[model samples]
Target: MVVVKSVSRHADVASATSELHMESGQIIRYVAPMTLDCAEMNEHQQVVMLAQEKRLLFGDVSEEAEKWAGVSDLCQAMDHIVEIEKETELFKGKRILEVGFCTGLPSVYALEHGAVEATLVCTDNDALNNYIKPTIRKNNVGKLVNYITCDIEQLREKFETNKFDIILAPELVNTKPEYFEQMHDMLKLALAHNGMIFFSGRTHYNSCDGSMSAMLDLMKSKKCFDIMERSTFNNSVRNETAPRKVVQLMHKMC
Candidate 1:
């Protein structure tokens, strides 16, 4: 049997850094502050556990979307978000806009943990819409979250400039390489005074082609935000190809 400990509601920032461990045959489930000994659960059940971990809570999705996104990537992404939150004091009772929150697990986690409210944005899809709306209710965070299915840039009408206390994009930034600059501008507009932008992307240590270093250099030139903290983690899925993952917190300058 594998022993998995759940994070307590009273867990301080120091304790938020606890890592989830999975043995070859053991699965760990984090449903809010409760931890399940998943030894008796099967593969499908394990997927359910992972879905909950990926976002605050995952409602039912069509079998196709579930298989398309896969369990390992979703779980790994959530793990990175968890680590990012741990390293900074960004999420408690603050207004947040989580862009491209696939599975909505991180959104729910932020809301339940202390984020006053979260505006969740993702590409509009019938399957995801059906899954996330119910998931928000099922997780009992409906009052704490607003669901939006539109382009991030179009949020100009939905939210005012300097409105959100924190803006988060776990892995979505790198996926939309074409709109990287536009997305950065959207984040800048959505951020409140002294607000934070927490983002993650694949890093290239030596290559100058669109690496995190190049991105940071560009941001420095813009002089819009100050780099508050940064850390790297081993990519769980692309262990060999994309070994290092870069997560950073930027404070919007006054």
Candidate 2:
């Protein structure tokens, strides 16, 4: 049998990533802030337990999304953003635009963490803009992050073209219903020379075949960017699994 020990809510125990023991041939689900005694596992269950460790073990997406509120257990995402900030030299004097500024988490977190030299344009669907805009201002980052509650399709009405140095599009477009044209347009209009665009999405956001194909094709047609780094980030924690394996996109030759 597997011994499961649960912990307090909204807490993550780093040490819990250790190997787990399976109670039966079937899968045993465990969550964060929990302790497991793996000594009583059969060999097969032990194997399964090991596989489980590879996952994030974070809770349900909706629950966590609400509870964590903003950028919780997203240290890795923040780390990547920080790297981009450093490479682009984004600071109080520079400009950065994040396409899907939900909860303004990445924008505010980025500001609170680094890129203090940047003027951030935190844009999102009009519906959610008000929801997170107040939080953005409340973060005391009003001077750094300017909230714009508009779709990427409506950027020109708000700001001039080539006005930003860094563009971030996290969880913006999914594979279905392809937001490629609109995304491409926004990127072209916003980023200036030496500007870098960062996105975290899945390949299916725009196409049935895959999201990467459309993105690659569009970028190639534009001939304005050099694909820098594209990789998969599997941050799946079960019961709270990510929608899909996230595709990380980076560009420089803009």
Candidate 3:
């Protein structure tokens, strides 16, 4: 059993207790959603509520989400880690580079399991310093993580070539061709030969629109990455607003 200590900026914020049942026979204690109305909650409180809701729906299997409970897409994050672990031992002794705002769950999980080190790249310094850094320290993986606040284009200037064995990009893929092109260049520059990249996001705004197919086409034309594995799962059970299908794309640098 693990209890994630709540770290909130609001002094008057009330903490609600909840239990997350994991498949590994571990239970994590986390803050449940407050009874306050959404209109009354501040921005920070609302973000916390959304995270707690995700943890409840997803069962907090990794004990990573609740520690830094905020604006992370918990469903996709959990699915990405679970699918990767189900297939490979990629985390063992490997260096990880996590791009985009994933709430640092993947990086923390990597260090806890066996990864030598991890670098988390995000444009938000406030989120990195306030939420992610504290959570990393609480999880006792602070020394293994290096947080950087920079745009995706700055990655090449910040690190040497082939710096990461695995690159995690959750909720970074979109329907835009230019977006795909930018991400493809960044992945090729940072990822080592034979390294893997995980790109995951919702299939559409509200319904499946085959946007993933278009994105995959762009990826295939790059020639630098080979599609290794792809899978999709439904998010309708927990999220009724959009309830869209989510896709996970695993690519290996050739």
- TM-score of every model versus the real structure: 0.59, 0.54, 0.63
lDDT of 1: 0.50
- Badly placed stretches (over 4 Å) of model 3 are 1-22, 25-88, 159-162, 174-177, 206-211, 229-254
lDDT of 3 at 116: 94
Instruction: Report residue 169 deviation for candidate 2 (angstroms).
Output: 0.7
Best by TM-score: 3
lDDT of 2 by residue, 135-248 (tens): 554556767666554554465766574477666656444434366766677677677666666665433421233354567677778775676543323323222222322233
Q: Report the C-alpha lDDT of model 1 over 1-254, residue by residue, as the tens digit.
A: 11233333442421222222322332222222223242444666655545533432233323222221222233334434555445324467688787743545556656755788988776757535444565566567878877677665567767664388877665543333455676667777777776777665435322213345556666777787777434333334222233323344465445
**Candidate 3: worst-modelled 10 consecutive residues by lDDT:** 30-39
lDDT ranking from best to worst?
A: 3, 1, 2
**Per-candidate clash tally:** 4, 15, 0
Candidate that scores best on lDDT: 3
Q: Candidate 2, which ten residues in sequence have the lowest lDDT sum? A: 66-75
- Candidate 2 residues lying further than 4 Å off, grouped into runs, are 1-75, 81-92, 113-130, 150-154, 175-178, 205-210, 230-254
